[model samples]
Every structure is written in C-alpha cells, then in structure tokens.
Target chain A: MPTLYIDLMSQPSRACYILCKKHGLPVDVQMIRLDKGEHKKPAYLQINPLGKVPFLVDGDLRLPESAAIMAYLCDKYSLPDNWHPGSSSSSGQAAAHQQQQEQQRRAVYESAVHWQHLNIRAGCMRLVFHTVIGPRVFKVPAVPQVAADGLKVLQQALKDMESYWLGGGSRPFLTGQQVSTPDLLCVCDLEQLRMMVAEPSQPQLEQLLAPHPIVRQWMAAVRAAVGPALYDEAHGKLAAAVARLAAAAAAKPAARL
Target chain B: MPTLYIDLMSQPSRACYILCKKHGLPVDVQMIRLDKGEHKKPAYLQINPLGKVPFLVDGDLRLPESAAIMAYLCDKYSLPDNWHPGSSSSSGQAAAHQQQQEQQRRAVYESAVHWQHLNIRAGCMRLVFHTVIGPRVFKVPAVPQVAADGLKVLQQALKDMESYWLGGGSRPFLTGQQVSTPDLLCVCDLEQLRMMVAEPSQPQLEQLLAPHPIVRQWMAAVRAAVGPALYDEAHGKLAAAVARLAAAAAAKPAARL
Candidate 1:
C-alpha cells in the first residue's frame, strides 16, 4: 500500500485523503502536524524537499502536491472517469476519435485544476491563513490589509466560478455534469472559511458565498458526490480547530484580569 | 489547424507559441494585444470567458490556461514523450512496469507544474507586474511595498528552486534530465524580469538571479533545448516592450519641460 503523509487540517491533504477513501483504495494515512512544523522537519524534507503536505509515496514514486497526487491515484486505481474525466484506454488501442475526445476532456480538467490553483485556492488559503490559522494556531499577527486583499481575490474567484466555470448553472460542476478533482480541490479551500467566524452559524462563509448561488450549488453537488460521511470526516480536524478558536475568543473578555 | 490566441508579451503565450514552433505543429497563431485590452473584449471573451491570453481553440474545444494549452498541444501532436513524460501507450498494451514508470514521470511533471504555478511563476509575475508592467503599460502606480513583498517571494522561489527542484544542479531539468513543459512555463516567467532594469545591463535580473546558480544553469539548458531562433522569435514582442520601457525611462528626466 502507498503511504499518504497528510494533515487533515490542510485542505489539499484532506482532498487527497477523501479521494482515496472515496475509492476504497487501501493506503496508510500518516498525519504530519502542521502546528508542530512536522512538515518542515529534516526527515520529512528528505522524502519531500518541497515541505508541503499531501505527499504520496508509492514504491519509488514520491509525489508532492495534491493535484498531482489525486491525478496519479485516479489513474492507478482506475477510478470512475467522472471523478477525473480524462483517461485513455490502457489497452493503447483506443481509436483516434475516442482518443481525441479523451484529450479534450483531459484538457478541460487540466484547465480547471490550473485555474483553481492560482485563483480560488490561492485566494481562500490566503484569507484563511491571515484571519484564522495564523492568528489562532501560529500566533502570528493578522494583517487586516492583507486579509482585505485576500477577500477581494476570493470574491472575484467566486464571481468567476459562477459566471465562467458554472456558466450560471449551465454546468452541474466546474468542468462538467460530474464532480472532478478540481471541484474537490476548490471546495476544500472554500470550506476553510468555516473558521473565519467566531460563531458556529458561519455567517462569514454564507455572506461571501451568498451572491454566487451557482458556486453554492456546485459545492453541494461535490459534497453529495463525496458523500456526507467521508466529507464530514475529512473536515473534522478543521471543525475542531474552529471550535477551539471560538472558545478562546469567547473566554478572552471573561477571563481578563 | 488549431488556433492559438496569444500575445508574445505574455509569458505563457510565448511559451505556448514556442512549443508549437519547436514541434513544427501547424497552428494558427493570432495576436491578442493585452495592452489594448483585446483579451477582455466581448468577441474574445465569448471564446475564452476566462479572458486570458494563450487561449487555444482546437475543433470544438476551447481551452484556457497556459499549462493546459501546452499539455493538450503535446498530446494532440504526439510530441516527444520527454517533453511531457507521462503519456501512456496508445496501443495500451504496455506492461504494468512500464506503465507504472510513466505514471511516476507524469506525477513528477504535474508536481513541477503545480509548484511553478504558485511559486516561481507567481513570484516572478507579481514582481514584474508591480515594478515593470503595471507602472509602464497600465499606467498604474508602482507600489513599493508590494514590489518588496514580491521580491521576497521571488527570492524565496529562487532559493527553493535551487535547493528542492534543481537540488543544487543534480537534475538537468525540473522533472528530469529532459526538458519539459514545467521548464518552459517557469523559464518564461523568469524572463519577464528583463523588463525591470532601465539600463541595457539587466542589473535587476542579474542581481536577483546571481545567488541561485543552479536555476540559472537550468534556464540555460531550457533555452538551449528550445533553440535560439524560435526562442528569440517567441520573445520578440517582449523584447520590443522592454526596449520601449528602457527608452521611456531614459527620456523621463529630459522630457520634463
């Protein structure tokens, strides 16, 4: 079995973990605590010099980056095409026409993945780090200006998803009617907003997502496809983190000397 | 023939253009002048919606994002496997061992591409935009603080490339000894720093690159692999733009009446 080194608190790590679980691919899941800086340790760096989570080791292949890991898993396990949407026949005898069709599907899928990396994921991760994780977990001071800039990018990304990717609900998911790796990658980042609010109502996430109903619809579809059990399990650590932050915030005034 | 809408001034556009030229792929290269807002115009928006340069149209498929465009072109034209490194045999009868090796290569390639998107490409583009393009072309005021932050990112990216990706010149190219799409994508972004300095001597580019000798060496290999003639042609417009910027900067004091 391949070994997946990840922290569920990390969005991409959770995405990869859920992907494996969703497919019943038996693999060892090793948690690398980001709070303790385990990812940057020399041992982990030996395996993955990039020092990032969601590192996959299958035989001699040590792959880092969630997008690549998910892609490799899909191909290796022969997951449903809808989940990734672009695998040529292993028989190598796929007709030219069918191969062309697969190429187009693969290209569309790649476009979504690339777009997510630079836009949705970048924006959301920046915002969440500035507002929630950095302040609460790392004790890093939150810069309001940086957080504001992050919000702007996040908003633009949400708008673009509604207008371009979803095409005003014309497509059931980002690339097509089925949820793919891009959807998983993006939705996980957006889910990080759950930590943004002090209250459990998650007003911040709602407010940001309200105008982009199509994005909301797409998120619902992706969550449903991944199934509630595994999806919630994937986000369990994040939920706990958010609760801890909320509790700390609530106790601050009452405990003051 | 497929149509590639691009502006050579755009790094990814030039990368795609050069890839097609290198492979002798018959492609219709159309210019979309970003300075003139051509990419954002309704006609172009109708096709790409993402409103980015290096948009490719092959038959019914309309692909955006440079990484996707390059990958699709590589597959559609059946470019050398080393250029991409993970294409499965079309006959699909390859042994499991060979297929596994290809998957590993492809995974490594994907990791490089993903890393470039967020690290090297992001840092270089941000720095260039704030210091060079934004002030010069868009008439947007340069934000020194943002430029400083961009420089930090660019510097860290260079260091990471040297230590992690290049492994102190251990590997010839990003993924392997052979040149691939990640090399093209990253090298083009680094090339943008040429527009930063005012004098003929690109001190800014040189100074930024001086510490990371491995990255510089890898860049030389990518350029050699692409060959000078086509590579020069691909960067023609960017060179012209850089010249214009230099001329404008030189005349700034004298033009003040």
Candidate 2:
C-alpha cells in the first residue's frame, strides 16, 4: 500500500486523487491542508523539500509531481491496456507500427503535460491568485492588470487546445477516443478555473471562458467520465475552501482598507 | 529518414541532435536559423505554428518539443534497452517492479524536463538575453536590474539541482548509471550557459558556475560520453553565431548611443 500526501485544493492533487479512484487503486490518502499552512511546515518539508502537494510514498520510493505519480501508478499497477498503448503485449510489423503510434500519442501527451506547467497551470493559478485568492486569503487587493494578463494567456491556451490539440477530427479526448492521463490532468486545471469563475463575485473570469465552446464541451465530458461521486469527492475540499474565502470576503470588507 | 527542424543554438534542439547522433539514427538535419529570424518566417511557421525550433517531422507525425521528439525516436527506433527500461521485454513481479522503478525514474526525468522549461531554461535564457544578447544582437543596453534578477534565479536553480536532485546519489547521470534523455536535455542547457560564459567579455557569467563542482564534473562526464567530434558538430553553429555576435558588438562601438 502507498501513502499519497495531497491537498485537495491543489489542482494536481485532485487530478491524482481522481485518477486513483477511476482506476480503483487502494491507497492511503493523507490530507495536507494548504489553507492551514500545513504543507509549509517543517514536517511536510521533510517529506518534500519543495513543500508541494501530490507527493507519493510507495515502499522505498518517494515521488512528487502529479505527472510522475500518475505515470508511476499506471506502470506499477499495470492498469488497463488503453491508458498507455505501448504497454500492450503484441508483436509483428503491425504491432510495431501500433507501438510507434502509441509512442507518438504518448509524446503528444507528454508535450501537453510539460507545456501546461508554464502556460495553463501558471496562467490559471496567477489569474485565480490575483482575482480571488490574493484578496480573500491574504488581504491583498486585486491587481487588475496582472489578472487581465493571466486571463489573456488562459484564453490563448484554450484556443490552442481547440484548434491545435483537440479540434482535429472527431476524437473525444486529447489523445484519442479514450480518456488518458493528459485529459485528466488538463481537466483538473480547467476545473480549478471553473470553480473560481462560478463564484458570483468574479463575473470577469466567467467571460474569459464564454467564447471557448470546445473547452466547455471537453470539461463536461471529463467530468462525466470521472463520474459525479468521485469528482465531487476529489473536488469537495476545494469547493469548501472557495466558499469559506467568499464568506470571509463578504464578512469583513474593511480588512482590505 | 525523418527531418528534424532545429536551430543548434536552441538548448533542446542541441539535445535532440546529440541524442540522434549518439543513437546513430539517420536523420536529415534541417537548421532553422533563429539569429536570422528564419524561425519566425511564414515558411517555418507553417511547419510549426508555434514557430519554435526542435520540431520533428516523420512521415505523418509533426511533433514539437524536444522531450516528445526524443521519446518518439527512442520508441520508433527501438534503441538500446538501457535508454528506456520500461520498453524492455520481461515478465513477473520482479519485472513489474523493475518497470515501476523505470517509470518512476522516467517520472523524475519528466518532472525535471518540465521544470526546466520555466526554471533553468527560462532563467538562463533571460540571463543570456539581458547580459549578452540584448546588447550584442539587438543593440539594446543591458538593464542591470533585470540581469541581476535572472542571475539570482539561475543561481538558485543550480543550487536546487545540486542539493535536491544530484547530491542524494553517486550515480553519474540523472536517472542512474546510464545516460538518459533527461541528461541530454539538461546538459544542453548548461552547454548554452557555458558557451556564453566562455567569452572574455562575460566574467560575471563565468563566476556563476565557479562554485558548483558537481555540475562541472557531471557536465564533463556527459561531454565525454557524447564524444568530442559529435558534440562539437552539434554545437558548432551556435558557437559560430556567438562569435559573430561578439565581433559585431566590437565593430559597432556607438550602437548603444
């Protein structure tokens, strides 16, 4: 059995949590509350020097980064053949070609995952921080210029997702007909954005996603695939945190002054 | 044979070039010159809409990003078993565990590759641009503040690499005893810095690498493994470009005015 140290409010943590549930991998889920500054403490720092969420401890190996954790689980558990086609046991030239194609698919998946770190993940986190988190949690007033810049980057990323990655052909996901790791990773980032924008206090954030129909449809599909029970279970803490922030913001307007 | 579109000056492009040479993969090297604004031109833009170097064009697959290109080559060519342990043919729990460890190794590789995009790569690029490129190529004076900031970030990344990733092990390379793709990628970025710092005009840049003996030794090992002829061949264009830039800077004394 492995122990996963995670904070539900973190986008990658939610992705890893949902991935484990979706695959039926039984493991201990240890919550590290980010809002309570639990992740920054010395105990957590000893576990991960970076003090980040989505760290995995299995036997002798301790791993951080959600992408790595997801890959480890897929390999260690040998979960279904569709998740990674290269893992399939087949031979011949046709098999070779299939393996090549699967490798290409994985390359694309890896590229997107890597690109998301600076683009989607960074942009969304900045946007959320500037518009909501900074003001609500830290009592720092919103910086409209920074928020707008973040929104612009997010919009371009959404457009790229549609035109370059997903909009090609009739494939339902980032890689193919099946829901792969990249899809799960991407959807969780967008869900974080969706959570922030759903708040009545942030109408400007809502308009950023309004023109991207493809992004909207893809999010809905990912949500349905994860299933409501698991999706809610994974995202429930984040939702509660957002609600608390909103209530706190409403309660003390003078704190900003 | 696949066509690899690259600019040798670009760090990732250099990695892919060296990897292909090391593996003896027959590839048509097509240079997209960034110094001449060739990458930004319409012809190159059609090949890669992102207008980035290190794009790979195999029969039908047009892949961008060095990590993706490297993985595809490793898969399609079916190179040595050590390059990618998970791709090896084996059976049972021990094999499964080996595969798991390999995947974990790869995950760390992936995490570093992704982190480099924003940290080492971005920081080094900014440092180079602010200290060298801006003044020489663009005729723009270096802003001390921006250059200092970039230097600070680069120094911190090098420290983290030593303390967190490398200091834990006696392994020669990033993953293990064998040289892996992540090693190629990281070494190339460091090589870019080395090229810039080697110049007589950039004493500050040279000082940055002086304290890190581990990084220096690891770099020497990677260069030796890559061998002299192939390594120099891959980096020749970039070296020449840097020289020309330096000569041009000397020629135009009053450009800053």
Candidate 3:
C-alpha cells in the first residue's frame, strides 16, 4: 500500500485523498498539517525536501506534487478510464484509429491538467492566500491589490475553462463526458474562494462561479461523480473552516448590541 | 504531419520548437507573433479559441499547452526513452522491478513538469512581464513591488530546483541524467530574464544564474545535449530582442551627449 501524506485543508491534497478513496485504492493516509507547520519540520523534510503536502511513498518511490501522485496511482492500480482517460493502459496493440483518438483524449486531458496548475489553481490559491488564509490564519495583513488581481485572473481562468474546456456546455466535464482528475482538481481549487465571501446561503464559490454557469454545472457533475460522502470527507477541514468563519461573522453583529 | 503555431518570443513556444527540431519530428511551423497581437486576432482564435501560441493541430485533433504537445509528439513518434524516460513505451511484459523503477522515474518527471508550470516558469514570466516585457513590449508601466515579488519567487524556485530537482548537483537533469522537456522549459523561462538586465559581456541570464551554479551547469548540459544550431534557431527571436534592448540602451547615452 502506498502512503499518502496529505492535509485536507490543501486543495490538491484533498483531491488526491478523494481519488484514492473513491477508487478503493488502499492507501495509508498520514496527515501532514500545513497550519501547524508539520510539513516544514526536519522529519517530513527528510521524506520530501520541498516540504509540501500530498507526498506519496510506496516501496522505494517517493513522489511529491498531487497531479503526479494521482497519475501514478491511476497507472499503478489500473483505475477506470473515466478517472484519467487512456492514462492507465498504454497505447500498445490498439488499432490505428483508436490509438489516434486515445492520443487526442490524453493530450486534451494533459492540457487541462497543466492549465489548471497555472491558471485556475494558481489564481484561486493566490486569492485565498492573500485575502482569506493570510489574514485570518497566519495573522498577516491582506494585500488588497494582490487579492483583486488574483480574483481577476481567477475569473478569466473560469471563463477560459467554460469557453475552451467545457465547450460552452457542449462537453460535460473539463475534458469530456467522463470526469477526469483535472475536473476534480479545478473544482476543488475554485471552491477555495468560498472563504472569501458568503452569501445568504451560498458563499463566494457560488457567487464567483455565477458568471460561468457551465463551470458550476461541471463542478456539480464532478462532485456527484466522486460522491458526496468522499467529497465531504476530503473537504471536511475546509468546510469546517468556512463554518467557523461564518459563525464568527454571525456573532460579531449580536456582540455589538 | 502536425502543425505547431508558435511565437519564438514566447518561452513555452520556443521550448516546443526546440523539442520538435531536436527530435527531428516533421512539423509545419506557423508563426504567431505576439508583438502584432496576432494571437488575439479572430482567425487564429478560430483555430485555437484560447488564442495561445504553441497550439498543436494534427488532423482533427487540436491541442494547446507545450507540455501536452511534447508528450503527444513523444508518444506518436515513439521517441527515445531518455527524452521522456519510460513515457514512450508501455509497461507491458516488463519485470516487476523494472516497472517500479520506471514508474518512479515517470512520477518524478511529472512532478518536475507540473512544478515548473506553477513555480519556475510562472515566477520567471511574472518577473519578466512586470519588469521587462510589460514596460518595453506592451508599453505598460512597471510595477516595482510586483516585479520584486516575482523575483523573490523566481529565486526561491531556483533554490528549490537546486535542492530538490537537481539534488544538489547529484542528478544531471531535472529528474535524471538525461535532459527532459521540463529542463528545456525551465531553462528557457529563466533565460527570459536576459531581456531585463544585460551584463557588460554576458547578459542577465548569466548574472541571475550566477548564484545557482548547479542550474547553470544543468542548463549548459541541456543546451549542448540539444545541439547549438537547433537551440539557437529556436531562440533566435528572443536573442534578437535581447540584442535590440542592448543596442537601444547604448544609443541612449550617445543621444544624451
């Protein structure tokens, strides 16, 4: 069994955790708390010198980066095609036409995965770190300009996701009908904005995703595909953080009276 | 034959061009100049809705993102194992030990590739745009603070590359001894800083790379591995841009006198 070092608060970590659970891939889950700086300690650093969460260890192989970990798991365990799409089974002995189609699908999937890392994931993390996590958790003052820039980039990425990946609602997920890892990674990253602003019932996620209905629909599809239980379980820490923020804001008004 | 749309001015585009040329892949190169706003035009956007350079079109398949393009080309052409390292051939009929080793290598390469997208490539581009590209090419005022932050991130990423990816000069390439696509992409991105500060004899590329000797060595290895003719051909536009900046600066002193 591979040991997965993850912190649910981290977006990619939760994505990997949910992937392992959803696929029934037996993985040893070891929590590496980012908030507590456990990842930066000497012991964890020994395993992964970069000191990032979602490090995977199986036998002699030590891997960092969530996307790589997820890909490795998909290949090793031979998960279903929909999860990664043509990534597990190699392109050996397939017909020429089928091989070409599989190559295209894999190419599209790879592009979306890379796109998520740079744009959607990077932008959302930038916004959350500057606005929510930095100020609230780390006690660092929020940089309004940086946060605003992040929001702008995030919105643009969402628009690109809708226009290019989702094909203006023509395709269901980021790549295709079957939900892929990028879909899960992207939805989880965008959901981080929920900590920014809360609506009457919904939070920043719903509002920020308001302009891109296609993206929201895609996110819903990915969540449903992963099932609500595993999704909630993986995101339990983040959800709790959102609830606490809400409770604190709700109490501030009554305390003034 | 596939068609590659690229602007040598763009870092990823140049990297892709170098990959195809070095591997001797038959590709029809279509130049999309960023200086003329060609990428944003309607016709090009029709081909690639994202309007990004380094879009690969093969028959009915349309692919964007440099890494994806390189991966697809490697698979389609069945390129050497060293270029991608276990990516070309499947794990069919391989011994269990060899399979595990191959998986580990592929995982590391994937991590480095994804890490480059978010950190090294991103930070370098951010710094260059804020300091060099924005002020010079786009006529946008340079944001000193943003540039400084970008520099900080870029330097940290270099240090991480040294510590983790390069393994303190233990590994010859990003993942292993053989030069990979991530190595090409990263070195190209870092070289973009040459536009910002030109040294007396050497340029900003050398000055910025001075602190990280391991990275400098790794870069020299990649350049030599790819051969100078193709590498220089791919980076010709960028080299000309850097030369133009130096010339303009030299002429400014005479004008002042």
Candidate 4:
C-alpha cells in the first residue's frame, strides 16, 4: 500500500486526493498538517527532501511533486481513462509497442500542453497571483495589473480549451471531454475561484465560463460526483481563509472611517 | 513533420528546444516572432489563443508549455535512457497502461512540486524580481540585498540538486545523475543564470556544482553531448540581451551624471 500525502485545500494536493478517491485507487491518505507546517518539518523532508506535499511513498520509491506522483500512480495502479493520455503498452511485443509508446507520449504531451493553455491553469494562476501576492502583500488597490493580466491569460486559455473540449460538435472534458485528469484539474481550481472570487453568479464571471456548456455541465457533475459533503469539507477551510481576508479588509482604517 | 511554434529566447521555449534536440526528436521550428507581436495574430490564436510561444504541433496535436512539450516528446519518442526514470517493464499488459496514465499526472505534480519550493524558483524569481522588475521597473537601487536574496534561492536549489546528483550513484543527471527531463530543465534555466547574474564563476555558483561531483562530471558530459558550439549558440542570445541591458542603463542621463 502506498502512503498518499496531502493537504486538502492546497489546490494541487486536493486534486490528487480527489482523483485517487474518485478512481477508488487503493491508498492510505496521510495528512501532512500544513496549518502546523508539518510539511516543512525534518521528518517529512526525509520522505521528500524538498519538503513539499502531494508526494507518494511506497516501500522503496519516494516521489514528491504532484505531477511525478500522478505519473507514478497512473503507472502503478492503471486507472480508468483520463489520467494518463500518452504512454503505456500492455502488449510487450514490438508490433504494439509503437502504438503503446505513442499513447504514453500523447498522454504526457496532452497533460503538459493543456496545462499551459487551459482555463484550469489560467483561472487558478490568476487566483493564486492575486490572492497570494496581491494587495495583501503588495498592498495595491485592485491588486496589480498582473492579476488582471493573469486573468486575461486565463480568459484566452478558457476560450481555447472550450473549443477543444466543449466548444466542438461532440464536447466533453478538457481533452475532448470524458472527464479526465484535466476536468478534475478544472474543478479543483474552479472550486477555488468559486471560493475566492467575489461573485460566481455574475455575467462576466459567467462569460469566462460561458463558452463551453459541457464544461459548465461537467463542473456541476463533478461537484455532484465528488459529493457536496466532501466538496464542502475540502473547500471549507479555504472559504474560512477567504472570510478572514474579507474580515481583514473590513477592519482596515479606511473601511472603519 | 511537427511544427514547433516558438520564440527561441523565451526560457520555456528554450527548455522545449533543448529537450527535442537532446532527445533527437524531429520538429519543424516556427517562430511566433514576438518582436512583431505575431503571436497575437488570429491565425496563431486559432492554434493557441493564449499567445505564448513554444507550442508544438505534432501531426494534429497542438501542445504548449516547455514542460508539456518535454513530457509529450518523452512519451512519443524512443528517447534517451534518462529522459524519464524507472525501469522498463516486461509485463506489457499492466505496466504499460499504468505508465501512460501516470505520465501526465507526474508531469503536473513534479513541475508543481519543484516550482512551489523556493529553492530554484526563489533564485530565478529573485533575478526577475531584482534585475527585471526591481532595479529596472520598480526603480529600486541595485540593492545587494535583493540580488543576494535571489542568489540564496539559487544556492539552496543548487545545493540540494548537487548533493542529490553529485554522488557515486548509478544515474548521473540532476535527479538520478542520468539525463532525465529534470536535468534538461535545470540546465536550461541554469544556463540563463550564468548570463543574467554577474560573476558566473563565483563560489556560490560553484558550490551548487560542488556537492555533486557526478553532477559536475555530468555537466561536462551534457556540455560535450550538447556540443560547445550549440551550447554557446543557445546561450549567446541571453548574453547579448544582458549586455544590451547594461549598455542601455549606461546611456541613461542619470547614470551619466
């Protein structure tokens, strides 16, 4: 049994956990206490000298980084469909080997390519850029233009991805639908945006998500499938953090005056 | 033939080009011509609306981001031994399928893990912060503190990577001592550092190379393998860019005074 290490609300970490549970891959969830900085401690560093989360530890193999972990797990357990898009060959013979290799290559390529051009990364990076380094740290009014710029990048990404996945005649997940790793990625980050951004109900926000009805529908399905209970459990802490941020904003001298 | 839609100087694009060349993958180089803002043209937008460079078109596949490209190529090609890690499988059925699915998962996870840690990122970001944004845009003095801070992150990453790879171990790349994707990643970014930072041969720079004698040996090997002429060709532009920056700074009236 592999020991799956994570912190629920730490976007990428949550994605890994959700997928593992979603696919019903057999694993043990070892919560690395991020709030207490257990992730930074020496003991955990032995597992991952880099001292980061979303790492996996098997008997001999210890891997850190979510992508590395995802790769290791996909190869190790062989999940259903979406996780791995490229490589892997079941038939050892030279005949199918090329096709298998092509599959693996395709999977790796798809994941990497879509990541840069997808709304999942686009919206997520914007949220991170703003909330993580925005007015809070840089003390700017509407955050920096970089935050807006990040959103623009994401907006373009969403448009591109929507066409590929949901914009088409058929439409599905990030990689032509079918609810693969990319879809989960979108939901994981989108959930964060839904938690972070002020109005999820507004038209501009909806416009960002408007292109692909499949994405919208899939988002709803994913929220339902992941279960509203776990969804809230996973996102509740992040919500509280947002609340604290809002409270702090309210507590400011200008706000009080 | 695959079309590589790219601007060669961009750091991520450089990572893609090196991986393709180093692994001996064939690609048709298509410049997005950043200087003319050609990336924003609708024709290119049809390919990648985000307007970033180093997007790859393999047959019908269009992928972006260096990390994605590397993953895609590694998956698609026969590949050099160290491009990916782990033993090759004999059981084609289970092993191949598992590997394909996880490849994307790992790509996402590893890049995230590596970037999240301040080690290499801190240094790279510090350089961008100090040199690109700080002194240049933000109008801070050539604050030794800021540059020094950048060096610290660089040092820490080098120390960690060197100690791990600079060993009497089997593999000889950054992660395992053999040339893996991470090795390609490190070298690409490190080459930029050599130019952008002053005093390339400084001890802190060497200290990063020191812990791993294997890494040092491997660096020589990568240099040799990559060919000194090509290595110089690739990095030569960055060197010129830095010099241009310095000359422009010198030409400023305030500096003249």
TM-score of chain B of each: 0.92, 0.84, 0.94, 0.67
> Best candidate, TM-score-wise?
3
Specify the poorest-scoring 10-residue window by lDDT in model 3 chain B: B197-206
Quality of candidate 1 docking, DockQ: 0.68
lDDT: worst 10-residue window of model 4 chain A: A195-204
Model 3: which residue pairs collide?
none
Best by lDDT: 1
User: Candidate 2 — which residues are off by over 4 angstroms?
Assistant: A87-94, A129-153, A194-204, A246-257, B88-108, B126-153, B194-204, B244-257
Q: Residue A108, candidate 2: how far off, in angstroms?
A: 3.1
TM-score (2 decimals) of chain A in model 1: 0.92
Q: Report the lDDT tens digits of candidate 2 across residue range A124-197.
A: 86678677777765577766655655676677777777766675435677766777777777777776764463
lDDT of 1 by residue, B89-110 (tens): 4446678987777777888898
Q: Which ten residues in a row are the worst by lDDT in model 2 chain A?
A: A84-93
Q: How far is candidate 3 from the true structure (C-alpha RMSD, Å)?
A: 2.6
Among incorrect, acceptable, medium and high, the docking class of model 1 is medium
True lDDT of residue B66, candidate 2: 85
Question: Which is better, 1 or 3, measured by DockQ?
Answer: 1
Rank by DockQ, descending? 1, 3, 2, 4
**TM-score for each predicted model, relative to the true structure:** 0.93, 0.84, 0.95, 0.73
Off by over 4 Å in 1: A88-90, A198-203, A250-257, B198-203, B250-257
Between the candidate structures 2 and 4, which one is better when assessed by lDDT? 2
DockQ top scorer:
1
